[model samples]
Target: MINNAPEVLRYAAFTTDPAGGNPAGVVLDATGLDAAAQLAIAAGLGYSETAFLTPGPTERSFAVRYFSPLAEVPFCGHATVATAVALADRIGPGELLFQTGAGPVPVSVTAGPDALEATLTSVEPHVLPIPQADVAEALTLLGWAAADLDPSLPARIAYAGARHLVLAAATRERLADLAYDFDGLARFMTDRDLTTLQLVWRESVGVFHVRNPFPVGGVVEDPATGAAAAAFGAYLRTLGETTPDAVLTLHQGHDLGRPGRLRVELRAGDARVRVTGAAVAIPADVA
Candidate 1:
């Protein structure tokens, strides 16, 4: 329904540098754009995902939809953060609400020392066991063996907004060599309704290194993935790995050379996980 091309704002989420974090296309006002139009824009941009926003019932609430190059997804964490930071740049930092396919997400934007940061509180998250057969198939696609998996962190399907299969690598080297069967993994994920494979390695008690293989989203890998980080927090909590009020640090994108950091916080008595990160606008010429 859009007669003209809408202005798309590009921002890199989870990093202060425009080139560091995961790049997400943000359309602040996608009022008349239909699903096809939105998908076209997303595919043209060719980022991991893009977010479209329309006015909601409340003044500060918006109906948000996310799309990757290949398909529409339930939610996208990095896009949400990028959109919030972009809005804060225009309207100033404050609280905002986003109604998404997964559920209602409340985001708070605040001024940081270096740049504006946004924290989105996810809907209640849950973790479920992955069937051994499915896990074996995924491992085969990654060329990883059972012994390469860390015993401490068992494979599980975690969901905050989108679903991801959490796999822990026994060693950092194993996590870095990530060449995989692209088409096969894409088919595997599509069949099982998986968004990404969250491959992680713990550096310390509260610090971790992560990578997201997003074949289903038509990307080889995601530089920084906020939704997977949120789901990881829930997965850790369900495994009794951390305290109720644990604040975990996730380091991502180093392997791809676009380093980004994501902060995952678990509030006491609240099942919802909070992910905080900084975002910077990418110039149109370079975006």
Candidate 2:
């Protein structure tokens, strides 16, 4: 129903600097828009995904939906951060609730000396083993040999609102080369109900380099992936690789020239994960 640009707010999640994180589009109010309209806008913007928020005055939360150019996603982390930061700018920094298709997500925003930072606590996360056959197929599509994989970090299907296949690379070089079979991987992901392939390479125990192949979303890669970070936190816990109160840092988008950082926090006695980052506006005229 919005005939114009609808005041799209741009933000780069996970990094304080505008140049160092994943950029997302946030439409704070899209209550009247339909699926087709949402898709059209996302496609037009062409930013991996866009988040639409519908306010519910009576309720403590707002209805939220995520749309990629290709389809609707149950949840999207970077977009959520972007939306939260956008809302904070208007409504003042505070706690906000989002009712997504996956579940209710609570976000908190705080004002920093330089900029505002937002933290989102994910829904309960879980991890599942990836089938060997599927892993082989995915590896083939990505042109990655078995030796390129990291044995320490096993392949898994992790879920925190959405599902992503976590494939850890043996080296940073292997993770940087992202040329893959777009249509083939897309088909493979669709068949398995996967949102993306969370390609990664661990730099250290707490630091990692990552890339997300989102062919299903009609995007080549996601700069900073909040959902995948949450899932990866669960994946690490399931592997018994990290302590209960561990914090992981994910660096992404450097390969694509839009480098961003995502901070993931895991707490004891809580199945949910927390992802924190900062966002900034991308001028409508520029992008």
Model number with the top TM-score: 1
Candidate 1 lDDT for residue 250: 98
Off by over 4 Å in 1: 285-287
Among all windows of ten consecutive residues in candidate 1, which has the lowest summed lDDT?
278-287
The sequence of per-residue lDDT tens digits that candidate 2 reaches over residues 60-168 is 4688999998899999999998888888888789999999999999999998656788899999999998789999999999999999999999899999999999999
Q: Candidate 2, overall lDDT?
A: 0.88
> What are the clashing pairs of model 2?
20-259, 20-260, 21-260
Q: How does candidate 1 score on lDDT?
A: 0.95
C-alpha lDDT (0 to 100) for residue 11 of candidate 1: 97
Per-residue lDDT of candidate 1, residues 15-134 (tens digit) = 998879899999999998999999999999999999999999988899999999999999999999999999999888999999999999999999988999999999899999989999
Candidate 1: how large is its RMSD? Answer: 1.0
TM-score, per-candidate, Cα-based: 0.98, 0.96
